[model samples]
Target: MAKFPLSDLRFYAVDTNVLIHDPNALFKFEEHRVVIPMVVLEELDKLKVGTTALAADARQAVRTLDSLLGAATPAEIMSGVAIIRAGGQALGTISILMPAQQSNLGLQPNSNDNLIINDLLVLKQSTEVADVVLVTKDINMRLKARGAGLSSEDYHNDQLISDMDSLATGYHHVVGSFWEQIEAIEPQRVSGDGYHQMNSATLQAILERKLYVNQFVYDDKEFVCRIYKEVGGLVTIELLNTALLMRQKAWGLAPRDLFQGMAMWLLFDPEIDLVALNGPAGSGKTILALACALEQTMESKDYRRIIATRSTRGLDEEIGFLPGTEAEKMQPWLGAFTDNLEALHAEDFDPGSSADYIGAKVPLQFKSLNFIRGRSFQQAFLIVDEAQNLTPHQIKTIVTRAGEGTKVVCLGNLAQIDTPYLSATSSGLTYMSERFKGFQHGGSISLQGVARSRLAAFAEAHL
Candidate 1:
């Protein structure tokens, strides 16, 4: 809660983009009045005619408005509609900019955005509403509102953090005599597996922040490390054994860095159902995910088949439409999948014969994000590649589709998001990683160091 006085409330005139971006933006402003221009509603009506995410948001926002105005009379609605929440608790009032009340207000109604701003300009003079600010997701609308001498702000309730660095890396850097501190504590042996038990309070005090089960803790001084696991106020720490990783390979792909090694461990852990892999381009985000999926599905027979999907939108041009079946249409978008497959084949299989290489191709099913709704994946390894382009709602939809024995692996480079209106902080990849950081059954890793080539790494560092 802000420290400002509650009585000094302000009125926010919302734009169409804000409501479309987040349907519940109406109730986000606590104890502050929300004003809606008729032009915004007109824009929503036009946007509500499609099957896209924006269309769904538009319809939902309209439905929310209808419910708010359900018990109000026409006169009451014109003046102000009481905005009641789920518990019938009224936070504030919502008023629509009526046609009869539309004043010229020294601005032309040529554009709907301009008209919305003009609505606030007129309300500031005609009503006693303090601070008629225009809240929007559109940068141009916010600028125009401010240019007209009106207060403006971006809707920020959905934003979790402004900077990506604020997110947990799932790896804590322990410093200075960490082994001596552990040696001082007489830990009781948990099992034959080299796990030492410690007091939960002591562990919490030493770590400061709450450590998620399975989160890695490491010290650069001699690479002293442990994995965290807790049960009922009792915490267990196991010496991280990189020897097992050194002896193993997933579909002919080995971990290139410490972060990649941690990501691979999480991917191979059967106890974890969801794993998020984040990195820049050429960091093996896709390759690692694919290798883990193949190892689980084909080699280990842990799952039935692998289902791969990605946003059709690309960096340069979208794979707008293609002929043939879904697999054929998605082939262009699956270049990463094939590229990694070819690389793995060249590295793992006999180089003399193309037959072995062709046979080594894992059984894969291509899925489109648009058709993923109302479907459940059971006993399958579902890989969502290029997930940074996905919205938080889209990520939720995909994650919820997992059925029994289904593991979800989300892979993406946050710096390579092609979707408009998304940033590093707001990308679904970042949101998923941040939200599921400490969950017992979920894990996230941000891969560092490029593993592609010297040339690629140089280009990434400079360009």
Candidate 2:
């Protein structure tokens, strides 16, 4: 699994952003040396003060570091301390790179990043160097490190895919009849639903990648089937009527495209607990998700309420300064939901009043991501918007807050991520989709095309 090991182990000096991005990254480097600079510790100490997600991560990183260094003396810490795993197996050595005094590598004073680079430069020339490498999430820092004549790389342990185009789209689109590729199948009817059981190896070329329970296979011959069960090299496919799926509706909203139609089926079904919807702007991601939430909550009573939150920069810092309740403060960030609700009820006799009535009567709540931390929601539809902006660690923290009977819908356009130090391939949304690809109760659909307007669709394809 390792790229290279044994004699090729290099010293990986992690940056503050890397630690904040993932607290447990210290132990991820197996059998290699991990170095933490003194300036990094000072930065962590200064940041670990607030209840914000960033502060929480800082505190966790500090705690993890403190726990790892347990009772090591200053001299031993400077030399190296054995980094032990959870099972008490010593895998690698971790040490603090002391401040460099006589090194000529120091840049302009007062910047922790420059100071860390200075210390790393000195360490690179020391006897302990197998090959010095700086691991950082900051692109500019990586450039600076390389400019200062040092090895550097981005944190890739959590980046599952190397290319964004290789990401799963949750469905296989076949132009011809799907049965043309299948050699044989055991067909059955379960309580009026058509089911087919076939050897997975027979459909290897059609499937391409490994088959998952929630993935779909559709053909232009008016055939659509989902992999509902897989056991002992055989897959049980639940056949879905293409016409029926295209007619699926939620909260008086009909899908504009086949992708939206498929997404609505998955989001409306209580059997699936997590649905990841990603596409370009105006691909009906929010509208479809909101419609499904309202349908399940207000109409079917499947959920008690809808809890909405999104990843926006400076939300944690600016939300506390706003002059209202948490819901009121979050209203600005969650305008997409209200905006889509208005669209959903635009055909009503009084759209404004209808939207207001639902807002007043329905239990729709806007929550801050900061407040969502550590809180559990039961029988709730939790929509996490702009998930592409979240780190793998932050998304995991929020998703784990789901209590029994709660369904979490993560929506984002990977190409539209705004968060610094994140890429389409490295985004939390992509990470979650990849990690949950095989989950029996989770499904992801990368909605295709811009379904907003002719102008928007033209711009999406051309501009």
Candidate 3:
């Protein structure tokens, strides 16, 4: 399904942010004709002057355009350049829509957006295309295009799930009786490894409700939770050690709710390489991840260091080039890190040594996504907070950097995504959770309970 091509191809007018969000969106249109406005190139030129991800995407889009139209003549560019992928495979036709005589969009001639709309209108009037659809990520741009009597749509080629709420929570509750459900299936001793296996028919019966590997299944009647581990063709269920989980405390923090306990289990698992946590604000996502990372790095001595990072994109702030060292520059964006550190340090009243001790004991390092390329993190516990602001490409880049013996935990609230071009469904956090749910070394959990103060929870619900 990932490599499926579009069947009903049509002329698609792409916007600047669409190209910036996915650099390979040019080739994603399949056999359809893609029209690029000249003004989009102008926007890309201005955005390509930075070291940010947007700049990298803009440069990549320009390079892709150059590679597609490089050998073509001016007349060919006017008509269309055949879009070819690597290895010289023909995919589709791409063309540049140049500015012509005055258009009648009733907007100012100097407006760049109106000019693009006018170009699309010109194509609709002159070309034989059955439909001219403007594909963009900007809602306002789509509204304006539709207001001008032009068809518009969101570019959904990069989205993993159509609805983010349909994602798995890595857990299910079995009501009524637990023994009644398991009495009929006799557990066969698969090996001497303390794991009993269920028969194929029993596994099929369990899978009728759809269970993922390493997903937690709980029974309220029996007050037991088991971790479903699929091995060979049979399903193995292990009783969750709730007593051990309840007795454990990491970095002076404890799981206050059952969902938080589930999150902690996934976060601290040595076998699970990637853990994703989603919830609303004050759900203990950041705090629990930091606590587990600190435990794994400092107390358990499992990982060498804890690397904490998040997308610097903000709703009301921008991460412009600042005048300072790396640590000094990233200080503003590490407020969550600072807050969690303070929470951990609140247990100690010793002012002088408490801060220094936490810093020295927890081998933690802060990183910016800007300079994370071409780097490998080995024997490290990497926590990516506010992951909802990242694109799927950025998440892929970050996760692929994990060398051997590295665990990555991504935490975020889908409702709080602040990135310009990302939605709850299209965010990297949602994409990762959907794609990694069935993997043996991956687990995800949705933390529903808010662990913050009463006032905060009230505001989240009523305000």
Candidate 4:
């Protein structure tokens, strides 16, 4: 762990989500005098009234404040901790600045983000007597804070994996005589620490050779064994015959959507028991996974059912009382699922049957990270979407749910978006990629291209 220069700091202005990520943040900064910039408290208050994960976090922050202030006014500065009601006047180590009287300064209209920025500015001006650091997880906000001459930093609550190469160490790259030698051995079942690391060409070769279990092959002089093991087992997707051809046609594509093809190959591979997909927005992570599920369920009948799930990290505020059964409550968060289904159905799939299977073919299940406890899945093609929002702990919860004959596909964009405490490198998707890199059944591919639209790709790059 890196040591922070905490001894010299007198005031630390904490961002709302930082506290929400870990409620014990108050005690984490124990010895140092901390300031909950009034604006942050107001933001927490607004969050507390909602039903989303943020609301739950906000309520926790309020409870912590109540413990400190003992029913005092919301803006009261008690003890060394000052709870400034955002926009209220208070003497503290930081001042909350309102938006400068200008509309063209890139401030979004009626955005609370603007208020947070203004508050940070005020706190920066007021803290002239001490060193002040504005902490936030937002990249744009960090950029803006730097532009104003304020010392700023990412919250560091969630970070990406440090070693990128570690995500591919499990699969052996075969060439020359070794490749031919393995082809000759023709193992019936092949297992490695990370099987997903193998390219589609290698997988296809294994499938064509009809190799059985206990077969051994050599990569050069290094001997590799064919041990049958299941990690995240094969994901059977039912897709249109065209979709299957599209993937088979894209064999060995090395660019943005390569992961899509890779995932498709894994779904078709009988040897691979587990596969993981990690990428950013417009990377075709979800689309490919959905297509694979469709193909397997409708065509091969390889798996009993396709199970799709996403962590409801940021569903909405006041979601607990949304007035509906489980399916109805899930409508809003499952919009992405619906959109992906609609696109797949457009490829000449029967819409009537597709609707019937929307909740049945690839049953989209809305499960929070907290609800994954005490569950086991078997013989299922499982797809975990939006995996970037999950923490390492949360990822373990979902992955461990895999029972016999279950292949889990974790899909998410490392960049473009994340949850409050997660980032591109530190998210569960990256964690799994790195941790399971050496496993024979586990595979990971980073998606880079935007297939949604030309304008979407342009916006992702330029805007």
Candidate 5:
């Protein structure tokens, strides 16, 4: 946990992702002297001209900045907000440090990241009067800033829940199972207090094993309620089957494997028309979803098509317009989907003609979330990757687009990262889990382990 001396900062360089994460970042840092690096503004400009959610946010930020500073000079203060235009904006009561040509730092062409570093270098060289810090989401950028003798820190807007156990306790509970032993107790009569008391895994074990309903399992000489069911319902059946198939196909799996059984369980619920999976990096959420999708599409015609999509959060800091068709524009973001498909095909399907088989049997369709609006899907299996980066409204739009018989699965690692304002608890994943709880048809599961490798698991746990 890195701590910052908030009162000591004189100048803060805002990164583009920081702005994209929260358009109101400017207002949030009202008392601080903020500087939108010339490169960052340029990156935001490119996003403002687009149709994606990030672009819309960038446009809003630009509007807010314009309103705050309507042509003021350096260090001129109005309404307690100081403004400076380096890259483009021509307004405000802040000092704009335009670096001389010699301070360019010779950044690579078309690299928004290099440009940002160059801008930071210029700010460091030009601003000899004010204390400056570089704020960004990119770890590499932060490292580069440090290397250049400038202070740097990650944007802290997306963190809503600091303690995982505290957040988990909100819905988790432990209680005695007296009601289960009582004959003729209606299922609907079971109170939420009883349900919330048990960890999902324990409840699931009781239900699957067909243990005596009212039998007391001694932990500390205390009786706990046993809520279990013998016959698995439709949703349970889908989840169990999918989990088993995924585990069988993927070798070297374990109980806590993030992308093996748990990922499948999270994504494949017959009752949940929409599902979301969030985890950190190397969790295998995407791989598991892709594997389950491939299994269903190949083994059974459960869905007409496998539609995979994601929102480009503008991780790259470039300003040039995207060239070519939608497919070309989407190539960068869809690389994960492609990689998962290739891995699955390499492991399960025949290698010599796997491409032909993928083309024929898989029929995986890739699209950006922006193009998903206004189209209703019927009998389709939809997977929304990187869902943590989306806003509640954007998530609502995606979920409502599901037509009859459409099952939508959302997968992302909350701890690994996301856009600003969306935290692990407040993200769409958490929202869906709370909203859909207790529906016999809907289910939610959180994956904890790294399934990729021992090193990956160690890194996830320690790094």
Candidate 6:
């Protein structure tokens, strides 16, 4: 149904944010024609002046445009150039829409949105593309385009899942009995490593095709199993020690529920390279990640340091202008980690001092995403909070920086995404989680319930 929104449009005029969100968006339309307004190029040029991630994206978009349109003459440019991928597959055609004569959109040119709407209006008048669509990430821009008698749509090509509820919660929760499908078990490995071989083709029918590797399956009767391997019709499930999982501790923290337990299992597992935690506002995502990070870095000595970061609107443009050292500027955005640190040490006589001491003791560094490009980290525990605000490209840029022996944990509340361009289904957290669902070294869990406070939980439910 998500794919139903985007009918293969013959002609599409893309907005600047769409290109920024995915720099290679021009070539993704698959044999269709893509139109880039001259004003959009000008907007990208202005955004290219900063060192932020936005600036990087703008520069990349401009570079892609140049690479495609550089050798073309005015006549050929007026027509269109074939869009080719880096893998040498030719798909669509891209052309620039120049400034048109006075348009009848009746909107002032005080904003870029108005200019694009006016340009599209003029283009529709001159050309037979009366159904030409404006692809954008702005809701108000789409509304304005409609008011101007132009068709507009959201950039939904990268939205993998149509519905948010269909997205996996990193586990399969069954009602009555799920073990009835199991026919045989290997007693040797079952006693030694908790491994059990079963026919998952039968289980897939039972669960309706939600099963994947590294996903936990549990029933109401206290049965818990984690799928580590899936070979054709046969599936390998490692029965989990529920008592040990419930009693799992990182630093001084414990899982509030089985879902949180599954999340922490992925966090502490030496095999999992990426762990994603999705939940509501107070579901202990940050606290759990912080606890595991501390346990691994401080006690286990598995990692060298901890890098904390997040993505928020206006953070890229304004972080550099803030007064203070890099750490001081990042402290405001990273206050959640420190706040959770206080939570971890709340039972101490002096929780404030304990948090401070732990902060000083652990090699925890709060860094901004602005300067994270092109840098690599080895033996590091990278925690990316507010991951739902990230675009698919932006998250890829961050996750690719992990060197060998590094683990990344992404935490986000899809219910509270503050970015204008992202929704629960289109978030980078959702994108990465969907893309990495079957990765052997990756796991994700949706932490249920609100663990903040009675008032917070009440507000989460009623508000």
Candidate achieving the largest TM-score: 2
Model 5 residue 215 CA deviation in Å: 21
Model 4 segments beyond 4 Å from truth? Answer: 1-10, 21-34, 60-130, 139-149, 161-274, 279-284, 291-305, 310-381, 389-407, 418-423, 426-428, 431-443, 447-463
lDDT, candidate 3, at 309:
84
Model 2 Cα lDDT, one tens digit per residue, 421-448:
8999989999999999989999999999
Model 5 lDDT, residue 403, Cα: 91
Error of 5 at 120 (Å): 28
Candidate 2 wrongly placed segments (more than 4 Å):
1-8, 183-192
Error in Å for residue 103 of model 1: 7.0
TM-score of every candidate: 0.88, 0.95, 0.91, 0.53, 0.52, 0.94
Error (Å) of candidate 2 at residue 457 is 1.2
For model 6 the local lDDT of residue 255 reads 91
Poorest lDDT segment (10 consecutive residues) of candidate 4: 234-243
User: Using alpha carbons, what is the TM-score of model 6?
Assistant: 0.94
Scanning candidate 3 in windows of ten residues, the lowest lDDT window is 1-10
Ranking by TM-score: 2, 6, 3, 1, 4, 5
Superposed on all Cα atoms, the candidates' RMSDs to the truth, in angstroms, are 4.3, 3.5, 4.4, 11.2, 10.8, 4.2
Per residue, candidate 5 scores C-alpha lDDT tens digits across 348-442 of 54754775767666677876676676689888889887777665446776888889888888777667444544566556555555455444444
Give the best candidate by lDDT.
Answer: 2
Judged by lDDT relative to the true structure, which candidate is superior, 1 or 3?
3
Q: What TM-score does model 4 achieve against the real structure?
A: 0.53
Model 2: what TM-score?
0.95
Q: Tell me which residue pairs clash in candidate 5.
A: 21-420, 173-196, 173-197, 174-197, 176-225, 177-224, 177-225, 207-229, 279-413, 279-414
Put down candidate 1 lDDT per residue, 355-436, tens digits, no spaces: 3544456568887776677799999999999898877767887999999999999988888877656777877788888788
* Segments of candidate 6 deviating more than 4 angstroms: 1-9, 86-89, 103-106, 181-192
TM-score of candidate 5 to 2 decimals: 0.52
377-427 per-residue lDDT for model 6 (tens digits) = 999999999999999999999999999999999999998889888899889
